[model samples]
Target: MPIPDEAAASAAHSVRHLFSRRSLHVPGTRLGAIALPAPIGRRHHWHYWWQAHFLDCLLDEHLRDPAGNALSEARKLARGIWLRNGGRWLNSYYDDMAWLALTLQRLDAMEGRRRPRRRVRVLGDALRSAHTDELGGGIFWNTTRDYKNTATTAPAALFFARAGDFGRAQELLDWLRTRVHDPATGLYLDGVKADGSAGGVVDRRVYTYNQGTVLGALVAVGGRENLEHAADLVDAVSRSTADDDGALPLGSSGDGGLFAGILGRYLALAVSTPGIGARAAATGRSLLATTAERLWTGRMQAGPGVFLFPPRQEGPVSLSSQLQAWTMLEAEQACR
Candidate 1:
């Protein structure tokens, strides 16, 4: 069964009400708490990439309801990110910068505004510069430039494709195919070390978000070949990740919490995109619907108009977990 529109909206509303906080001194800036019922008197670590995903979720809400305050709220959150990141949009992590760049591009396109274009351009340039011949050609994960992985490269490919730099995007994808694509599992490995004692060694760990970004990048840079690859990836994810009832396993807290939801977001894209095989699309849709139903069923009420979502059917509540559930619910709604 498809998730109801009201349920998705309620999840969004609860997330905003429970996690959002405004900076008293900064006036216009706002940031999300790292956890719910935020721990008092402790210094909250600012998670750059997590905030980027949060911004993307806000844009998802805006697209769903044009008349709502989501766009304005997104603007404030973007501003907050800038302020928190020392007034610069470019971050050290190529993946972090790519995520922000993608969200900024979406914000500009949706609002018909040019304000984020400069930031997007800077981020794009940084990502391009990070892509070198190291590890047989892929973007480095961060400034240390010691590792190249699907987590960084795939999103960077999608960003370039979205920005009309298809040559660069395809180059990145080609490198991924050569270096990280696992033939047996049809899933991507984690990354490769650049200069350690274990240099040139493949991590070989499969991650849900890595598959999600690569799946998204392939669809974004669509042709007959890329579409076929995307379909195969969809099939691979369903085979390897889904349970008997098609629900994905629970991701861990912190960054892991967002993993399955990220995959669900791209799975929705595969379901909606043209030219993907029907079986692959059906597989994507079934996983999303099943997981969303599980999330809705497992939600715990926190207060009037606020609810907490675990990363899976059961776990401790954190901002990342709640955001993950919201991301999946929104993806399910989009598929509907």
Candidate 2:
């Protein structure tokens, strides 16, 4: 499924417009609570939605190789994910490994390629190993042997859903709602302790990404008739996102480039909900269009057909964000 030289160049040139040089610091020092200098800043670390967002988008455009397979690149990206070779798969579902799971299912459906049968079993084993009743029932960050982070848990739930493991998905969603969701804003707090309460925990912030994640999870579960306390979860997201101009910080700002990737995926889910009505969908499209335009630099104008990223706020647009933007845009088009 490798793109042909010409088509690949077109894809490369179009996508390259978003790349900019930036320094990602690897930590040599550790602060009290936060992992300063952070382990892996930007190398080989996949985005929150490479497949679900951009690569998929390119496939929709018939640009991901003339053969129409986005799954190929997805597998290629999986190789770079944290736990591919004897280690754990990244650390959370929100970004690296979780993103892989989200697209893997659809890609499998589309192209029929899997992680081999043995590989699938291995992932399944890893999933069971990672689950615990610790936080009343949330999956840990790594494969059960290590720590847990709410950041990774939500995506893991989505991954389970993608693979048709609905039962496990349900358990994770229940734990998230009970443990991290704050009823007031429909927004989720960061990681919770093993006991499942925000109280006495040093971490307590309603990030846009978490809200998007929890919202997407809620939407997924809400489809079932008898799911306990489903309506309220949707209501929370609606209330939190509603407001005056710029009422809340948009997770995917137009010019954020890479950061926009998170917003792109969340907005796609928010807009796709069946009963949400047309108004919600319109607003979502408007937001995505704005972000795309802002992130567009004059990269394509260069001679040999080169795409460059604008060194805006976050330096240059990230490759992942471009894919996310493209993927979300494709989803929007299909809905219409």
Candidate 3:
């Protein structure tokens, strides 16, 4: 576990090159976004929205129509996923609804095809449902208030922001602010004990995604502490998860989609606020380019970097990663 200089340097160069130019030239589409993944990509979670958000930013600000031919596929995949879901949760669903809803919202802003109305409503309801029977303190993981995890809250906030339900989103945000905090390290507690605050905590390890979730959520809700805390946490996660290039390391899953999506969301938030460094925008670009290169070069576009267990069972990456990759690119454009 030394470190990979080539990967780090290459990624760092991506940041410097983009920042120097100051804009992306990505393709602009009607909302379909980009091309479909080959090898029967799983609709497991998140269509292209996660990645599409990044691409939209790129097109709106940086690249030159990088997603022209892919919009049709993007739309098809997006529509197909909703068509079958009946515009609602399909069990085992965790934090994906917000991801999808945000995608729809971004696509709506991009405006073009005018997808199914119920599809939008369904995502709307799914996001609102995140507040179902709030435990007098905050939202539950699912229909049951059995356990509360750290990761879901940020997506919850993003979903609400996109839905125009800022009030409810703010409440949940407030609850999360108090509940998941760790007095020991000022880090989030990760998981809750159902009736208590310390039990069944599977992943207490603070990862970039975990903290990114916070930054993304807080930024969406407009909280000062959340923003500062997110920035601080990001620095911590970055120092640990990121390699020399400022790109995240493979131990944190990779330097591609995970890096792009998580950091891209934070970057977008940072760009909106004043005083962020030029490196922030550049790093955002570098990550997206790296992410795109990953998708473009990996497996047959199907089983590329897709993995189920991750590090444990390499290969066969997930659709979420691709979606995350797409989003970072979109965010990169926005950074400019």
Candidate 4:
């Protein structure tokens, strides 16, 4: 399962190219923004959530080349995010903030930098503030408070668990279990309306990142029960998410492009988790290896490590898509 050195070199070149073209140094702010590359047609611009994934990619690149500037670039991006929000990491979207907190926590663990403690605390408190008893207790997607989604709640739980706030993490876990989880499918549903009067209609669509963040949270706060739940989730996604050729489908370029890579990362973690059954671990590794091979050999075209999201051909390159592929490649190597 060692990634070909050519693949690793290609990934490094793609990541560095992305930083050069997409990253912005906001004058007078510590934030180095990774803005969306220019459009060929209709496209999203400057999504705040993407920077967190970018930092995660930088972490992978740093692991590949410790002597490289990945750490310095990550620090600048972290500070830029903080400074851009007017000295606060909190934003209208709690989910967006939670992603940053999670990334900062990992960056801090890896680099032991000075600012993450304060940043994580501030962002963590903000995430907790969004949770309410409205829909039987889960976090809303944004400050508007209209929806309680796994996208927000699961990552919030992960941040708390990773930051050692297990009590808060369990609160999120409890809410997810009783509310949005579809026991029949062994997967969490998409979301529910936050309005109590709406009777909490849960959207049943299964997104890979939602499943992933939940799995990651459970892994952080480990126990036999949590591991069992993680295994069930892996079973469900492994059976359901692949396309005809057995390549995992990341639905589209925007958020969908990152979904499977997110799952791949946690799946790798599942493989390494002690006491998880050997069968589950083997399954996880197989999924990672297979998906990485497909993406590396099939979807990548033109530029170094540039991946076209499945069926789409014409548009600016999706930085998220490329980052996710790099994550898959990195996870494949690390887990092996």
Best by lDDT: 1
Tens digits of per-residue lDDT, candidate 2, 196-222, equal 453324257656556556656655755
Model 2 misplaced stretches (Cα beyond 4 Å) = 1-13, 16-95, 113-117, 143-147, 194-202, 224-259, 277-279, 296-321, 331-334
What are the per-model numbers of colliding residue pairs?
Answer: 0, 9, 29, 2
lDDT of 4 by residue, 1-336 (tens): 434766644664665564443223455323212323554332434566877877777777787789988777777777766655566677899989888888888888887665458878888889888888888788989988888989999999988888778888988998898888887778889888744574677788878888888988888888888888888877777777766555566534677767888888788887888976787788778888878886676555555454343434355566667667777777777788
What TM-scores do the predictions have? 0.95, 0.64, 0.61, 0.88
Question: Candidate 1: global Cα-lDDT?
Answer: 0.86
Which run of 10 residues does model 1 get worst, by summed lDDT? 309-318
lDDT of 3 by residue, 89-135 (tens): 33344455555655556556565445535655776666566555434
Identify the candidate with maximal TM-score: 1
lDDT of 1 by residue, 1-336 (tens): 546777778888998999888743477777887776675643667688888888999999988888999999999998999888888888778989988988888898898874557888899889989999877899999999889999999999999898888999999999999889999999999998865553488888999999999999999999999999999999899899888988887665788888988998888987799999889988898888899998888788889977887644343357788788888999989987
Prediction 3 global C-alpha lDDT: 0.47
lDDT of 3 at 187: 55
- All candidates: CA RMSD in angstroms? 2.0, 8.5, 9.3, 3.3
